[model samples]
Target: MSFFSIFISTANAAGSPLKQFEIYSIAPMHFGNVNVSFTNSSFWMLLVVLVSTLVLSLGVRRSSLVPNRLQSISELLYEFIANMVRDNASQDGKPYFPFIFTLFIFILFSNVLGLIPYSFTVTSHIIVTFALAMVVFIGVTIIGLVKHRIKFFTLFVPKGIPLALAPLLIIIELISYLVRPITLSVRLFANMMAGHTLLKVFGGFVVALGFLGIGPLVVTVALYGLELIVACLQAYVFAVLTCLYLNDALHLHH
Candidate 1:
């Protein structure tokens, strides 16, 4: 193919909303019966991890008596998650503070990373989000089981309820409990995927319509601002929900 043809093909492929989500192997490999090949998704995840670690460490490396910009941000995020835990999950949730804080930072970084041009959004994939949610779900379940033993089952049964309606409520509660991962995963994945897709669509219009695309380009710029907010908000929402779930398992309020 000619150079111009190649460039056109590349540009068109890059503009597709779904194209950004594609998982292509970077260094294809196999582990016996499993395909554990490194992929764009995997690469992005590693990048996120590295960046998170670097920022947190370097941010406070100086440990100044008076905080720098980096130190201030690190402390702000730390206190934010700590206060959130205190308010939502109470002192009982203190032991799990590190887990919750790390969870928030990871998702928050993943969302922000996806905003980079041509970067993959790991949370946009159901499997990634589902895996994270499962950790929270299973962790809480184990905590409940270990703490309350068989009595944890009583969480599904409310006090002073009519015997006739007990079975119905139990079934409803059981299903809801089991479906936490699904809802949690879908909420993050759907929002990130949909918002990114909309941005991609507008971007394509800008390239295709040229001068006539000025309006769409402006909307796309506005969307970038909104998506940045959403990226942070979704991370906060997921973290808060996890706290609520943790509280439920720990205290059985609902």
Candidate 2:
């Protein structure tokens, strides 16, 4: 069955609007005590990767003096992200353009794909977003540690602080530093999930109200467009924050 058809059936079978977000095993597997089953979430994530790779590869494959639609889109995205990295993360961050670009594309596609009726929204799941955030957190931490060694700890201790305030300030900085993953993950997760849930609610009302549904139908259409913009914005926000964090690791209040 087609993915959309399967999702439509699954979603229709469940009453709750949030049931659309549920993850269920498509192909079950087990190894000893471990249950590592293929799931709807996994399928959508894999699809995102495939779609991103395919579009980008095709977009750049036939490079031209005057670009076609795919090439134009590819070049635009590349320049946009390259400038973003340079502006936010500085010259040192140019080396990591591929990572930032990939992160942005992946989340953007996942968020956009979820807007389709009954498609699973991977970023709406805390586990997925948290995992992505942790990768960034750990990566930047390692980069800082490798570049500055013990001096990396200075990130948690601002310069020119009063002696009395130094300890408290250090504690505050440290706590905030550690909370990066939680905040970053929750921002994307909460936005995507809440937006989808609200859309679903209004959509249901439109159906139930019939002719009186015009008001709710109009609201639902507007919400979908808003969510589309929000999906792209959230991806940009996440990528920008990542660049900012990487800048801290690379330049560290220089």
Candidate 3:
């Protein structure tokens, strides 16, 4: 049986840990046989976007000579991503700051917001993470192709290798490059899913044990804190990796 089905089967006996990840349609819609319903996932994603935009906009709306808390926060986030891009992708990366900033903010908010009770964690799903990764992968490839044309193929052929081993190394590199999306997506999805699953399991234990629920409750609290850190870290890691990839495309570095 599928993982979700396993959860569905046991849901009657005890709440399944995976139950939280289930997507529910808020407003079900069908275009012929295709379902395009507004789901909890969609709602959470929309909330994330709106929250991010409002926070950033409000943060700088009253910018002044003496920065207020909101303005300070806004500037900090701006500098954080700006420095990340410049440090990893170099000065040439300045032009792409907005794209990287938007990406980081979106993922960061999605992840952090998902930590809220009853909210859906979009990054916990492989499909969502994979789509984001593919966008980065495809965009990087396009930049490389446009900048270097025929030389873009050199990305798979490192700097120093014996002719005999060059072909083998190139093949290996090509395979690795092609799997970037899978690795990137799986990393985020697996971390978010595993963390939340553990939290749910422990939460269930707390309820089941009643008087002896203190231990599980404590553990659940700790996991929530850790998950919060992981959420931010994963967003930073994703942005950093994107900058690295962009650097490779722009500089043709091995």
Candidate 4:
């Protein structure tokens, strides 16, 4: 084989491995006329839920006064979310604690799990992130309406504004409010997807370079560590934003 031919074959093989990242439909079984199809993303979501449930359950199963290692860790996580809610959403945030806690746990687990080799990152996809963002958007909207009634429109109209500027302010507020879901979902999906794709591309370089791969390998490891921090940070940011939105719903601070 010529050198050029060998190079082409190696390049083809290298590219072929990336095909594992491709999303595909999984057919579990047919339920009569309906076909039950699951995507790789959905599978990861389910795994996240199951793993999170098991971890928390085991952590809290044996409640002791002094506390064991697992229980203490669980308690710390609880306190972290509690403090975040209290600080961001105020005292009334107590009512939305469950929703906020669940959001944090789900996102945190999904992100951390995705860091593992061969694992799928569901949050890397816009559909999953958008679905989550839409849920928050709808819930906040409903809460605002329920709490303020017709006064919910006040959210788009700033108080203390002059009558002359009210229309302009309202238009700006309306546009900002409408853009929340897009911003929230895209921020998460873009970050996760970009980080993972970069990591994968660098990792591929590390493998393809053979004996000269050490440079890319070291960079890949550094990036992996950075990605882990990003995973947690993104989850925290998402949860904090949700709390802020909930606060707006309950307090209408516009």
Candidate 3: 10-residue stretch with minimal lDDT: 4-13
Reference-based TM-score, model 4: 0.90
The models' CA-based lDDT, in order, is 0.91, 0.91, 0.89, 0.86
Give the alpha carbon lDDT tens digit for every residue of 170-216 in model 4: 99999999899999999988888888877777777767778877887
Task: Judge candidate 4 against the unseen true structure and give its global Cα lDDT, from 0 to 1.
Answer: 0.86
- What tens-digit string does per-residue lDDT give for candidate 2 at 190-239? 99999999898777767666687698789999999999999999999999
Candidate 1: where is the Cα deviation over 4 Å?
Answer: 1-14
Residue pairs that clash (backbone atoms under 3 angstroms), model 4: none
Report the lDDT of model 3 for residue 254: 71
Score residue 137 of candidate 1 by CA lDDT.
97
- At residue 103, what lDDT does model 1 achieve? 94
Cα lDDT over the full model 3: 0.89
Give the candidates in order of lDDT, highest first: 1, 2, 3, 4
Count: clashes, candidate 1: 0
Ranking by TM-score: 1, 3, 2, 4
